[model samples]
Target: MSKFLLSALFGAAVALSSSAFAADQTLAEFHADMGGCESCHADGASASADGAFEFEQCQSCHGSLAEMDDKHKAHDGMMMCQDCHVTHEMNVGQKPTCDACHDDGRQ
Candidate 1:
């Protein structure tokens, strides 16, 4: 391929890669951008605390679900929220995934 053509192809590849990265958002930023989960998990039976149990606040206590603990080194943080506790509708015995997040007892 000619140098000019090669350069154009490389540039296009770089642009696409950068765009993909830009689309990715950090967990904290995701929650901040959403302006809290009250929209879906708010009011009546689905009411969540104003400041408590928000995704951001949960991260503070739970830490990222994908991190190292005493027993396990890698956990799936991406699915932590769904893995534990039912949001919007409370069940009588709903418990957070202690073992799933912790993988051991350290967390």
Candidate 2:
């Protein structure tokens, strides 16, 4: 292959690999990077007082709870996405646990 073609392929590969989780990036930071907090907020100015707008934004991107796996569907109508999936408090690859709410001691 030509040197130019090889370099282009290498660049594309690097871009795709970097699309995965960033070691120290929080979910909130990831979302903010996409289009700023406004991507999840109403106008990038502030979070909703009741979080209703932010909740809608989450659903718009990730789909509604009823559309997710059983772990998420189980909480449909009971809580907002932030209740368990705290992006601001969680890292990109981290997931929320029942311990955040449930106390049955099941790990």
For each candidate, what is the lDDT?
0.45, 0.78
Q: TM-score, each model? A: 0.26, 0.76
lDDT of 2 by residue, 1-107 (tens): 45874575576558648776575888788767655888787778777898899999888666899999998899899889988778788887677887877899754
Minimum summed lDDT over a 10-residue window in model 1 is located at 38-47
Which tens-of-lDDT digit does each residue in 1-107 have in candidate 1? 45874575577558656764333444333333443444233441243544344545455444555554533234453444533544433342344546654567754
Q: Global CA lDDT of candidate 2, please? A: 0.78
lDDT of 2 at 14: 82
